[model samples]
Target: MRVFIRIFPLLATLTASFCVQAESLSARLADPLATEAMLPLRSASALAARVGERPCASELPASPLTPLDAVDLALCNHPQTREVWASARLQAAQVGVARSGWLPSLDGRAGVTRNFTDDSQLTQRNAALSLSWLLFDSGQRSANIDNARQLLDAALATRDATVQSLFLAALQTYYRAQATQAAVQAASDAERSARESLAAAELRYQVGIATPADRLQAQTAASQARLNTQRAEGDARNALGALANALGFPAQTPLQLAALPAVAAANEFQQDVDALIAAAQVRRPDLKAAEAQLRAADASIAVARAQGRPTLSLAAGPNWQRFEGETTRTGSIGLTLNVPIFTGFENTYRVRSAEAQLEARAAQRDRLRNQVALDVWQAYQSLTTATQTVQTSRDLLASAEQSERVALGRYKAGVGTVLDLLSAQSALASARVQRIQAELDWNIYRATLAQAMGALDYSLLQAAEGRP
Candidate 1:
């Protein structure tokens, strides 16, 4: 009775506090939008301020942005990166949950009972506190902990891989946007050259030096060049939109990109394929994640095997009871040994299943290693081809320029046919497009090789920005 008196006020106080909190929660739930559901939309200026404060947000000196700036923006703003980061955090919490198996647990219970028999009523009240600790579980606890730790490692690696993938995507899109902008300029130049040829042809026809057919052909070429310019401009706009999307911005956001530099010397990327393959094996995050998963699968096998073994535990409890006005206080301490005798061969089948999963994981790891090596090799070859194409395209552009100039000079001197001049002009236009595409392809393939080797990062973007 004395003990009950001492605890009664505390219980009543706790119950009152809980009731108040529950009522408050109920009110909030009834009008959830007022408290939680209705979030205020951030203004553009607020969003800009928030983005400006982030370390990864680009600090642009002007409207145009460098490749490094674009990559920084993507890293900061992209949802894919944030999603993977959140997943890693969740896996870390799961690791904590697994490790808690090593600690003891406590629980409290309370009950009341009422009975009526032979016109007499009996009432009972019971309260108890219990503690349980698993002293040993063969090796199940350790195995589970190991499994969780390995899974955490895998999640972290996967996050890194996702970041690298986003970087690669941003780089490719940036390059495409830059290339398309250059194409627009090239098309404008073509239009100017076509107009000049048309003017020359018109003067020649006025002076009876060229036929009407020549003037019509020149007109056709100029119109075609104008059309090409329009098409190139549209492509540039589309590419810019894609780049914005890659940076996790609205597709309609205006973005100005810095011009790409000329290709570097051929010796810049000279390396043995075997060396690259070895580097990929060391640096590829996806491969590392696969290895970690295999380790986790191996740990799971240990956990399954331990299920058939014995577990040692300790339990303790204290109780207070009142039945029909009689009171009793009781306490107990016990050590329990649990051994698995038979569960219809469940444990055996579980062990076998775990072993099978381990084999599958090992096979997957092996396959990923092979795939990584193959990717490195393929990227290396493509880079080599792209490098060679860059040189060839530059040479072709120079030759076409010289030929066009000579053809124009011959036509003005009244020695060359209009057909010859038109052919030269067409060749020049094609060569310009080819050179731009070749350069773009060379840069993209280089970035792809870096991605395959798991070396794509802001440093690579900086290096690309510094290229001549």
Candidate 2:
């Protein structure tokens, strides 16, 4: 009794604390407003900010897009593309800087200096303005200007090439994702068939009409089918990730590709391969860039040779001289003629180097032409093969569908073994997968051919219109 009494007050205090704490927790659980209010200031604000915020979807620009057009737009908007353009603009400025040498430049100077003599201090102030212009520097300035123009051309061509390649890569990724999705579906169907077969095998074994070994085989097959489905699902997810990344989306962002544009008909490939080659040579940007580089090199040679020659120019400018605490004085400018005695063989070497560069560029241009021809030919073959595969796969799918139907009918009539049913199921799944591959291949090849022909800027939809 004594001990009980002694512990009573302590227990009462503990109970009171517990009651208060419970009440506080219950209030928090019951009232979200109270709970939020009790949270740390920054944390609560963060939570509210997250909860009250709407998605930033409005930040995205609106545009009409086929896959290729979307890629073109992305390239245009990309930071790297903007930076490259900036570089080109800088090169343009450099050209202006080089051309400015042809005109006279004027400069002004003003300063005051103090000198201490043995016993006296002297202060002197003076201001003068003068101008200098290049009477002649051979043809260096002209050559530099020409080179800048060619560089601009090359930059533009490079930009175009990047755009084309990115467009093709996006198309390829999109089609690959579609193919993987198809494969996943095929895998799921296979899994379902295997499960059904396993059930049938079990029933037959129980009735002593099927061997235990058959039942085990069916079970193993079902397990393998499930594994295949898992693998296919993983592959499909990876493909989606790749496509989204290529399209310049966040890795976690969901992708929704619109229906593929109609494929070009087989009949349109009737144009001669040689004609296609000729078209590409004329239109391809890289070839144009190479040609421009060659011309620029030729201009450089001229500029170099001119560097060794004398230059004459007419120049006139007024100069002003000011003295502290005195009147300002002025003088008149006159014409100047300058002659280049020597540059220590610098100009000679430069000319020779420019000549060699020109020769190298000519060789490269020839190589580019050959490579373009080969690319066109390869693209043509791929397109032809893909179209034929699409046709063949379509027919195979139709036949496989019929075969599966017949096998299922026989099974229902108790006249088919599980083996027959399984075989037919496998065949149908393979056909579907093959058909998807064929379609994807066709799309890729078509895009490649368009790229090779320098027709990426053309409308894919228009190109495929009125074709089978």
Candidate 3:
């Protein structure tokens, strides 16, 4: 009865402890945010079921979506973003595993035996509990924990970097779609002008004031304008498909994007190149991840060096046995010290390998730093060039509009040739296309610069969209 009471309490305690540990580990592994992020990518129906709402697309307002909305959708639904989050969670669990090394481990055993002899029979029952713990291991335990923690930090930074990159991609795609839509409008206007010229030529020919060649030329221009309009519409549809893909939706998903905002003044990005580079170095998540990896490598070297030294551990065993109506109890506690004298140069090689890894990580970090600076410089220059192009294209568009107006007026007054009117109309169409392209380029470059600086986010999209 006493043995049963004693074993029951121990078993109960062990079971309770195991349940608590299991619950804690489960909580650590469960990530609601990542699960939510993955839901949209998996199926709209599933997301609707989970949230008790309609699909995301159906719930969107009827009004055209802004770039910020697109970026938000991408962040929520993109597999790439979810992948990073999952990786970070895995790394966090690894940190937990490393921490567990500090705690003692216990094992329980039970056995029953029966013996038969010529004149005797015997039954035996045994139970034992054993525990082993590392009392000291140089600094290897601490070093392992630190290495795991640094790796987790790197994983977190990598997730942020992925988010920034995906946001930039979605933003760029949104602007491209807007630009193509503008091109369709411009092509429609050109088609209208061409039709008007064709009408005038037909009327003049019927009145015997226009030659057959003039009528034929006007007809050709009208046909070309119609073709151009159709082509522009096709391009617009394709751009929308691309935008949908960027937003982590199926390519054919319909998206109504708001018109692109006007280009901002050059002064908005007038910070010195050196200052921009410094900001990028400080803010870039990829660079931070690299630095974290370097720290982990350094910690690994410490672990390897510690492995070559001595270790101290503690152990305990408590056992009970019942045989033929007799009972016995045994318990023991001991300390052990182990020194690594030699292992065919295994420790030496481990230290050497760890050092090499540390060197490689240091080199990689330096390379990343230089690459980050270059990214900032390149994005900055592109933004500057795009800003200038926006200005020049606006001027050209204004000139072309004026020229087309004058040519149309002169044509109506019988002072301008059909060729001159057609040329002016074509120039106006080209100017419109150029202006749209330039504006989109400016916005895309701005977003790229922010991404390169690790500052791309929904807020940046809001600011860019809010600009005139």
Candidate 4:
């Protein structure tokens, strides 16, 4: 009874702490995983109620989703996004695990036993509380803690990289859907032009001015136009389905997407490639994650070496027992020093393995560093080409539209040949399709360049002021 009273407070505190070291999922909400660098993820996390005061709607809104809206939906609702964030949280727990190495351990036990003798029966009651703590471990605990912290850093950076990748994907899908819808409109207009040309040919043939072959050619062109319209409609639906899926909706979910923003000159991203690569090396989250991984690997080497060193520990406990109508209480404390005499070369092998892993991490970081440069180079060039193409395509479309109008007017006045009218109409249709494609490429490549630089954020949208 005396021993129990002496350490009861410490026992109570240890019991309270050891009883629940983790929060229950159903009892409370998970912690936030987004960092300041991940703007989209922070907004999405709030939208999904992951880190916000109130729950948000998983279902999309009734209004047409803009580019930013789509990105938010994807970041909040997509499984891949949640997976990486949860994984980062898991690594955070691992950090806690490593830190636990510095703390002492305690245990409590209670038992009642009935012992039968030849002539009588006796009852025994016993209770004990034990505590053990490590005083020194040759820096092993520090190294492990460092490794865990670096790993957590890597996990956070990885989460950012994944969020940026998903952001770019959402933007690309949105632009593609818009482009396909535009193609459908262009195809329908071409079909209308074809029908009008057929009507003219029919009238001219009946008036004995156009040949039967001309009428037949006109009919064939109209049929081809109709076929093209149907195909375009099909492609448009596919693009919508893909967009819906990206936003975490069913593939068949009907989505009303807002029109693409008007294209603006992206002269801001026209900086030197070398300078851009340098900036990316600093800002890229994946590269930062790689650096953290390398640091963690280095810490592992220290952990392995420390494992072979000596460790000192302290142990203490209190005991209470009752037997044969007598009560006894006792307490004891002791210090222990442990020396690793031999480990059959296990520590040597472990050290060598850690060193090799560090080397491997260094090589991988170098490889990724080179890859980042190439990605920026390619994305920059692609955006530059797409910008130029968009400009030229607009010019071509204007010229072709004028030619088609002139050809149709001349044919109606009975001065232009049926072949000339059909050729102009075809040229106009092709030019419209090309221009729509050019716009889509330009918009997608802009997001692509931002993603390559590891800076796909609302700032990119702000930079354009009206575009994704």
Score each candidate by Cα lDDT.
0.84, 0.72, 0.83, 0.86
Candidate 2 vs. truth: CA RMSD?
Answer: 18.9
> RMSDs, each prediction?
9.2, 18.9, 7.9, 7.9
Q: 138-212, model 2: which lDDT tens digit per residue? A: 677888878767876776666566656666776687778777887888899889877877887888788888788
- lDDT per residue for candidate 3 within 128-154, as digits (tens), equals 999999999999999998998899889
**Residue by residue across 1-468, what tens digits does model 1's lDDT show?**
999999999999999999999999998766533322212221111222322333456433365877766777777777777687677767766776777788899999999999889989889999999999999999999999899889878987787788778777877889899999989999998999899899999999999999999999999999999999999999999999998887777788888887666787375777888998999999999999999999999999899989899999999999999997888999999999999999899999999999999899999999999999999999888889889888999999999999999999999999998889989999999999999998998888888999899887655655656532
Best by TM-score: 4
Q: Give the distance in Å from residue 442's predicted Cα in candidate 4 to where it truly belongs.
A: 0.4
Q: After superposition, how far is residue 116 of candidate 3 from its true place, in Å?
A: 4.0
Candidate 2 clashing pairs? 138-306
Evaluated at residue 271, the lDDT of candidate 1 is 84
What lDDT score goes with residue 198 in model 3? 94
For model 4, the run of ten residues with the poorest summed lDDT: 31-40
Error of 3 at 201 (Å): 1.6
TM-score of 2: 0.79
Candidate 4 per-residue lDDT, tens place, 329-416, comes to 9999999999999999999999999999999999999999999999999999999999999999999999999999999899888999
Among all windows of ten consecutive residues in candidate 3, which has the lowest summed lDDT? 39-48
lDDT of 1 at 205: 99
Q: Kindly give the stretch of ten consecutive residues in candidate 1 with the minimal lDDT sum.
A: 36-45
